[model samples]
Target: MSLAIDFYDETNTITEEQLNMLLELVNHAAIEEGVDAGSELSIMFVDNDRITEINREYRGKDQATDVISFALDDEEEGEVPLNLGEEVPHLLGEIVISVQKITEQSLEYAHSFDRELGFLTVHGFLHLLGYDHMTEEDEVEMFGKQKVYLEQYGLTR
Candidate 1:
């Protein structure tokens, strides 16, 4: 059992090795969160401009944030699409990350690029699993889980 991750890169800020690490990080996030291994996810790396456009179009935000997660499992919200039955894969969601934010935040936070990227990846994945930071309690829980994944993957700052 393994996650079917579809990673797409729209920027060349990271190397292939970085992408491999991201894949492993996401897989670990799913497993640690008790998500089935056969689940699927999609990640897209884009520049600041692209992310800004997405933010504006989706969340009514005019700024370019770090990452955005669009969960596809919200049946109550009518966001999930009806499939052709059991044969269809269990798609978790889509995560869009901005390479520019990764670099800038890494420098601002005094952490390595890898660490920042790992944090963003885990944060995004957790969102797909219904984790959020809208409250202080939820922030602790969500961020704590993210730290665990990053530390286990040697991405600590």
Candidate 2:
């Protein structure tokens, strides 16, 4: 999938297998949505304090957030093919995740840490692909697609 993941924090809570699973999950979603295989995406993991600062700075929210996506492509222009005429990979965007929040939410939702992390990863990936939940209808559609994709990837909780 040409996905590049960078862990911002030194904790290293995510294993290589888990990271591969996430990449495959997102790659499957992108393929199903007709995105090119050469598309490049990045996922970054950070601790609570770091994510809290990011939330405040980027989202104007003082609290910690589970995940944040910075999409590089404009959806309004349609799905752009990655690596079309260039040797370099297309920069899809960055997804920043708070490992602290994932742990907390796993407990809150009564699910395993892997499940929560996988869910959050999928959610963040979707956001990078231009999915949003600004309205009730949008929420339904986005969340439904998330559920479908997760289940298809065997990440169901």
Best by lDDT: 1
- RMSD in angstroms, all models? 2.1, 3.0
Runs of candidate 2 with Cα error greater than 4 angstroms are 1-9, 75-84
lDDT by residue (13-73, candidate 2, tens digit) is 8888778777777778887777766767778888988888988998899988899999987
List model 1 lDDT by residue over 115-154, tens digit each.
Answer: 9898998999999999999999999999999998999988
Choose the strongest candidate by TM-score: 1
Q: Return the TM-score for each candidate structure.
A: 0.93, 0.87
In candidate 1, stretches whose alpha carbon ends up further than 4 angstroms from where it belongs are 77-85
Clashing pairs in 2: none
Instruction: Find the number of clashing residue pairs for candidate 2.
Output: 0
